[model samples]
Target: MRMIEIEKEQENPKMNNLRNFYERALQEFGTSDEDLWLQYIQEELGPWGQPENCGKIHWRAMKFLEGQSAESFTSKHALFQSGRL
Candidate 1:
């Protein structure tokens, strides 16, 4: 997972495009199907996604994501909180 500035959670041009792409991808994959929700969250929290909009992603993921995907996100978040991510 990559690190991103967690201040305010805004967006930029690159982030907008990435968001759009992810939305289309999620739509195609039916959201809960085969996916890369974690990667999306990482990108949203990375350099491309300027201000970081991962909070929304995290909440959505916890609700929609299942199995190992859900567990992975939980673990990553925990590591992040502990500054070990």
Candidate 2:
């Protein structure tokens, strides 16, 4: 546990930069952008995947996506939660 803490305290520079990049990009262009939200969600579902992180992003997305996009994301979320994704 101590080693894990130490490693996290020394986050990889490249990954740190990538996280910063995502923050800036989202701030500038992710508003009402379903595709960008989807991309960020997918990124969160990558190797560093965390359920809470994905949930937060998905909730945020619900505030933006509409019509067909919202429907699609909703269906996808249902499938994912049902283990049919």
Candidate 3:
């Protein structure tokens, strides 16, 4: 008989919030393409193929700048405009 062990999965609250924010932003902007999200993360957020945190940062910023608070940057459209859609 062989014994099997299962590793426990850790839950990150911050990451979960960020993911929720990203999903909301995507739905708000009506962007359903994964490639477009990847491209935006690469170009607007940071360099390509760096690390998970880097990508997360992009998603966070997009969520902040494009989600609901985006109205805050209405005057500074140049900064949050691109992320809006």
Model 3, residue 85: displacement in angstroms? 19
TM per candidate comes to 0.57, 0.53, 0.25
Show where candidate 3 strays beyond 4 Å.
1-13, 32-36, 39-85
Q: Which 10 consecutive positions of candidate 1 have the poorest summed lDDT? A: 1-10
User: What TM-score should be assigned to candidate 2?
Assistant: 0.53
> Model 3: per-residue lDDT, tens digit, 1-85?
0110110122322434334444554555423334334433443343223355544644544564544444433333344446644
**Per-residue lDDT of 1-85 in model 1, one digit per residue for the tens?**
1122322243444556567767666655534542356667667666667435778777777877677767776887777658796
What is residue 37's positional error in candidate 3, in angstroms? 1.5
> Which stretches in model 2 have alpha-carbon errors above 4 Å?
1-36
Ranking of predictions according to TM-score: 1, 2, 3
Q: What's the lDDT of the predicted structure labeled candidate 2?
A: 0.62
lDDT of 2 by residue, 1-85 (tens): 2332343456452434444556566676555456666656665665654545777888877876767777777777777668786
Query: Clash totals for all models, in order?
Result: 0, 0, 0
Q: Which stretch of 10 consecutive residues in model 3 shows the poorest summed lDDT?
A: 1-10
Better of 1 and 2 by lDDT: 2
Best by TM-score: 1
Q: Which lDDT value does model 1 have at 26?
A: 63
